[model samples]
Target chain A: MKRLKKVGLIAVVCLSLVACQGGVPKEALELSPESLQQRQTQTRRFDTNNEAKLLTSGAQVLQDLGFTVEDSETKLGMIAASKDRDATETGQVVGAILLAILTKQAQAIDDKQKISVSLITRPISAKETLVRVTFQRVVWNTRGQVSKTEPLDDPKLYQDFFAKLSESVFLTANEI
Target chain B: MTNTVKKTACAALVVLLLAGCQTDSRDQVLATSESQVALRSIQSRVFDTTDKAKTQRTIIATLQDLGFVIDKADATLGTVSATKLNGYAMRMTVSVRDHGTKQTLVRASAQYNQTAIEDPLPYQQFFTALEKAMFLTAHDAD
Candidate 1:
């Protein structure tokens, strides 16, 4: 019985140490001014003459990507849309919770993850328009609290959007 | 046997309590001087329209115009929150209160990531665009 008690004490100490571990990395949560500047400049610009045409194509691209348009203004050269996706399967959530209990490390499963897109179109010149797109992801745990937000920095994602926008612009111009 | 179990449980509880005492490092980031400046720069606006519902719709439209996704809008609470992505994540919250029969008070706060945005350019630009939206909304009504 004494031996069992010692083992239990050791286990408790180990569990407590593990539980004290931070879930998110320190770097992931902090943003410096220099990093912010670098990120701000990471935008895709499309060459087009008609702002209205660009807006229409941009809206279509968002729709094709499974985003629902929340608001759009042609004059303002802005379009906002969002898409919600399930981040974890039901089985994964159950397993994670069980593991969390044993490990004492909180395993936060963001069940509902949201991706929001904001597009801005501007006329650089009489015959040139520039389009910039920004994508943000909001992660929410099962408790519906925002866990984290990540700026989508994948270049390919931006390329894909621009490619579709280019196609839509061609189609729109052809229609005119 | 019971006493042994009780002592083990107590020790575990104490450890857990100590772990909880550790402060989250994220709080340190917000305490920085830059973050404080950003927090102090939040701005508000007032609208001439008396219709609260109409004002709310206009606010939603305005945020959408700026490429913000409306996260939550509560008419009863007179609050609306929206998020946008530039190079970073930006979240904006607008609170609307009825000033009187013909006026409404609107206050807007913006944050970049977890810290408040101290730059006036973004806020000014947003409110400027919002002014246009309000004009357009009024024009559409007529």
Candidate 2:
């Protein structure tokens, strides 16, 4: 009876300490509204009336960028693609340590990361179409649990995508 | 006495560790009515062409060109939805209907991470870009 009472008391104290640790820190989970607004404003638009041609050109551009085209629908005017990135040495080591501490399952030196891209097309008129592209980076632990989901908001990245897309569109237009 | 204390400590640790694993769901804030009214005011555009299919196709193409992944498209209903994520997720849905035999109306709404984006600039920019694309598409048809 005494042992049970002592255990209960210890459990209560430890649980209280854990509770004080709290949930995932807000900073770690959410991006600031200012940054989100900046990102939204920074996203540029493209004008094209030929939905079919644009869809084809967009797929070609993504493929040229080394992204595997996962899905494409001309009628829907949407494409999904993903690229694989090899984790850096430091990342792997730190991931391993974190995994061992968190889930106790660590047995790999090579961790692979993935970046996904999604594109949507909207039409404003018979002669106009608007395109929006989004990029995301996902990191998974050896246990297959998602560790991080970061949005890629580099202006240069968007510029590069648009540049390639323009080239593809030109080629498609000229049939060259 | 020592054995009893050790057993008690182990039991306590187990219970505490299990309790620590509990997690809370993230909270989301609702948009104000003023923002909703403002968003509704600018979410629509009128196209010159009466061809609903062509207008719908152009909208889909424009979304694709902008790098949004199409989630759903319905021709009979004249509705399309596409989603994109850059840290935050945005879903844009467009609905097309005939205003007259020679004119079509397009309505679009954007949601950022499940919350309505009440800003008019993004919607205006999108419509402006769409207008340009429509011109290009018309040129191509010729």
* TM-score leader: 2
For each candidate in the order shown, give its overall lDDT on alpha carbons: 0.64, 0.64
lDDT of 1 at A24: 24
C-alpha lDDT of candidate 2 relative to the true structure: 0.64
Per-residue lDDT of candidate 2, residues B76-129 (tens digit): 788877765444556789998877676778888877654465565667667766
Best by DockQ: 2
Off by over 4 Å in 1: A1-42, A89-108, A171-176, B1-90, B93-108, B111-142
Q: In order, what are the TM-scores of chain A for the candidates?
A: 0.65, 0.63
Q: Chain B TM-score per candidate, please.
A: 0.64, 0.69
Give the per-residue lDDT digits (tens) of candidate 2, residues A34-61. Answer: 5345335334445557767777878888
In candidate 1 the C-alpha lDDT for residue B127 amounts to 65
Q: Write the per-residue lDDT of candidate 1 for residues A60-89, one digit (tens) a residue.
A: 888888999886655456677889998777
TM-score quality measure for candidate 1: 0.47
